[model samples]
Target: MKLSLLLFFTCFLYLQILFSQDVKKQVEVGIIEHLDEFVPSDIQLMNEDGKMVNLKDQIDKPTALIFVYFRCPGICTPLMDGVADVIQKLDMKLAEDYQVITIGFDPREKIDLAIKKKKNYQSLITNQNTDDGWRFFTSDSANIARVTEALGFKYIKAGTDFTHAATVIVLSPNGKITRYLNGTYFLPFEFKLALIEASKGHSGPTMNKILQFCYSYDPVGKAYVLNVTRLSGTLILSLGLIVFLVLIIRKPRKRNYPKN
Candidate 1:
């Protein structure tokens, strides 16, 4: 029984590893988040009018910030659509209660593309001044780096495209990060609450990221791959636990004794 316990514990320790080598190989380039941290002051972007503007100067109300390129072949459009849908459904008035700012992370993109995208998404919502609230932009790579790094939005360029997480960053009126909404779709209730909290300068961590914990982002495939190592490790550990229990619970066999 002692030997069995020792073996089980050894297996448990081995199973817990789940192979760090896989994590080391996979680049962790998603939203790391800097809750309550103020966005850096100097990050500049070229607005739809082709004029340079400081990002900090634009935040008079709660803002939802997004990072994307105009030419993305995946995820970006759906994310923008989700934001537009939420905006259309929200009871709070747009441009008066809150605003959305989207930045094209690729420095090579120009403000003209941003303007076209603004119009494209603006068409999705009605009965509101979409032009004023849903703004798009482009910036040089340096400014892009500064803003993304400050907010913990990480991405990698891959053959003219990029690999990034789909998320919207909520910021307070004073430019402090208040929340992050992950994934392509936004719930109107949650979106409204995030904006409401931002208005009050409240910082909160939103973790609708169970899939991220269970999966690994595959840069080459541009999809989330299951972390088999973790699953396999857990399965092995479960088997070991069962074996340990059996060893502990089963009665020891008694040898027949001759009449003394």
Candidate 2:
């Protein structure tokens, strides 16, 4: 009787634990948002050529940062294809305004593999005018962590497989994340809107980047705005100029009285 009772209790505990897990999963699903605000400024990673690169450095121009493993036969290839298609459909003027940077998630993948994948993607996107916009890179674990951690992108390695999200981040010319495209079904309108938003309605970061030296792309406004520091300085300088002008204009005029 004692043995039978112990077995029954064990089964009951298992059921309770299962139910608790179900509840936790339900909560997680309910709480999931579009993205969890992952933006990294100082994060740096090594390129396939053994050169160091950072997101901040890319802020000089608008770059589409995509994360995927070169070996992914399922979602990654199609995801990349879809992005290529989206870029191809864009008008030439719009296409030239931005750049695409693809990073392989698997550090084990070598530069040759990355180069091959890049070549395949290039074949899919035939816009000769925008050829320069696309790039592929491989990096080590340290750089990957710096980037993934800052962007709130997470992944799990189970045996030989990886579980990760299908997402791409559009950063302003200044390297700040302006928008995130999630899932396989990416719409051209959304991508265009995000690109314009990132470009800040300037049509692209033609002039603002040099003067401001910051990563900021506002998709809605469609123009690059000054970074916080530059914006502040501009405001202060304007105020000072106004004060100086008032002093000059209001300076007491010398009395024009006849010589005594």
Which candidate has the highest lDDT of all? Answer: 1
- What is the per-residue lDDT of model 1 for residues 163-193, given as tens digits with 9 covering 90 to 100? 8888999999999999999888888899999
Over 4 Å off, model 1: 1-27, 208-210, 218-221, 238-260
Please give the lDDT score at residue 104 for candidate 1.
91
Model 1 is weakest, by summed lDDT over 10 consecutive residues, at 18-27
Model 2 C-alpha lDDT per residue in residues 1-260, reported as the tens digit of each score: 46545755665576556544543433311112223243566666555566767756655565677888888745677778877888878663433677888887787887788878877877766654434567677778877866766654566564565556556677777666666676555677777777777776222222211332332333344233446864565466557656755665676867888898
Global lDDT of each model?
0.84, 0.61
Residue 64 error for model 1, in Å? 0.8
Q: List all candidate RMSDs to the true structure.
A: 3.5, 23.2
- Prediction 1 global C-alpha lDDT: 0.84
